[model samples]
Target chain A: MPISLPDLENAIRTAIPVAHLEIEDQSNGCGENYAIVVVSDAFEGKTTLARHRFINEVLKNEIAEMHAFSQKTFTPKQYEAHLQKST
Target chain B: MFRAAFRSSILSTRPSALLTSSPSSFSKSLLIARRNLTQEAKEKILDAVNATPVVLFMKGTPDQPQCGFSRAAIQILDMQGVPPEKLKTFNVLEDPELRSSIKEFSDWPTIPQLYVNGEFVGGCDILLGMHQSGELESLLEKNGVLPPIEGEATKSSS
Candidate 1:
């Protein structure tokens, strides 16, 4: 019953109905804990912390159950930068 | 004995007066002192987390919480059967640098952070949802922790 990586993903997916989303479990400290690169127009007007907060709000329950989530809530442009950096 | 006492007094007073006497040194030294405190706080948090099996970096202590989220987290733990002895919490509201640095350290930009077995766990809402679904019980079981109650766990903090 412990929160799993997929459960965290499902929470974010449900919280932000964005165009794209990727959840990574970065518990290993090798960028393997948990990273969610979310693409949402909802991030347009929000500051970095605000965007993070939005994700936090969405995953409030999951956060309490799971551990170590590093989120990059992004607009389309920011998501694009993220894609480029990863590639 | 008089000379020893005088030297000790001078040593303590000398450092205390520098900041009060000079405005520039005051600000600069204050900045340095703040930085040292920040470093020390981070170390303390890490050590505490590493030492304790279950730890929470929360907005207030378990007995008296300051924020709704923190209060909710404590409630969830109580409902989920997490005993008082197994839990250790740090009040983030008391330390600004710790509040900010914890975000950076965990890359988890919120309070009420939970750690199980020296690993980072998510914040409040996540904990509640897990509790509801019974996932919390299993996690505690895996860690050799016993759950508090089976039914009648329907109490909310606020």
Candidate 2:
């Protein structure tokens, strides 16, 4: 089943201490595809691969049901630096 | 589907006395057998990854990707100037065994996985992030998988 954006967002929030989260539904209205940016202190000491794996583990069930799931993760400090650079 | 059939065939072939004596041990042995099968698949995957400097296990060919993520990964590699000669792609959709085995082999849950010098690189999101940060270019160059710079040889000669 297609998971709603809010439901997915809530799931992530419940699983991790999220600093910032953005979930964009890329599958039009189907909810099968999502592009998410997650900022969490839980990812502080992890490599990119590790961080992605952590999130992947957390959303295992949801991801199994979805067709596509794209994620970008950052620690709070990295997210701040990224924001500064982007702006 | 096929896995279930295969499992049933294996179970059927086992002597009924053993199956009745210790069902738990029988299942444990079955698990070990399955693990050995995966080990064989892992070796084959290792060979494939080491076959080229840049190996991409994607859903389809670079020219015609079936998934958006796979297409994006191909584009990133192209943008990074990964030489076609140095890169080898395996379409996971073509091989059912490979489709499942690659995931277990990499401990990664997704497709369009890139391997440089037999090392696992992240999927599309990571590739895009690295591409934007200019890390992908340096990585390809460092691996010697990218084409030579246009004017470097002539510049040195001059």
Candidate 3:
């Protein structure tokens, strides 16, 4: 019942208009654990907790099956700032 | 071995103590036939959350965290200057009931869940985000859970 990377990406895209998305498989080859960064306009005006809750709701089934899941979410504006700050 | 000891400890405690701790409205829904998590377990978790001002339901003790995320959480709290006396950690791995019940209780799927003043804060990712943003410092300060700044008090007195 391990979720494929494309399937997870598609699930997020279909649910929300993703501006940017990065998913890293942290569980070696088992595909259970994931570290993801998601950027979307949908996250605007929402607290970090609320954004995570929204993503959790979208991937509820996938998350339940996976062993561990970690995510960082941001609005487009924040993502832009984050990118500039990193570089 | 350890499981048996944990089980015996639960059995030794008065059943009334288990029943008396109020279960929140959210936990009542978990009572329905969906999962194996029990009402007694939820009540225990509720009590654990309120046991201290800063409660961390993690995979292991703060001194020796088993998971990377749990360790990172402990580090963040330490970096925030949260007093050890004000913090309490529950190793969910030690208790099967708590391991499952806490997820249902907080509506969060991950471990290393944090509670400030009995409110569900978030998991490691959220905590790390807050830590980097400087919001966690203010939040801890506002809640009065963090230790007082060293020089500020002395400076004001002088």
Instruction: Please report the candidate that would top lDDT against the real structure.
Output: 3
Question: What CAPRI grade goes to candidate 3?
Answer: incorrect
Q: Which regions of candidate 3 fall more than 4 Å away from where they truly are? A: B1-37, B147-158
Looking at model 2, residue B84 earns an lDDT score of 88
User: What does candidate 3's lDDT look like per residue over B1-158, in tens digits?
Assistant: 89755642343312221222132312322232224567788778778888899999899899999999999999999988888889999999998778888888887888989999889999999999888877787678778897556765212332
- For model 2, the stretches where C-alpha displacement exceeds 4 angstroms are B1-37, B147-158
**Cα TM-score of candidate 3:** 0.80
- DockQ values of all predictions: 0.02, 0.18, 0.17
Model 1 CA lDDT for position B29: 24
| Residue B127, candidate 2: alpha-carbon lDDT | 89
Ranking by lDDT: 3, 2, 1
Q: lDDT of model 2 at residue B22?
A: 30
Per-residue lDDT for B26-52 in model 1, tens only? 222222212233667668777888887
lDDT of 3 by residue, A6-67 (tens): 98897778766788999999999898999899998777776788778667756767898898
Top model by TM-score, which number?
A: 3
Per-residue lDDT for B127-150 in model 2, tens only?
888888767776776777864567
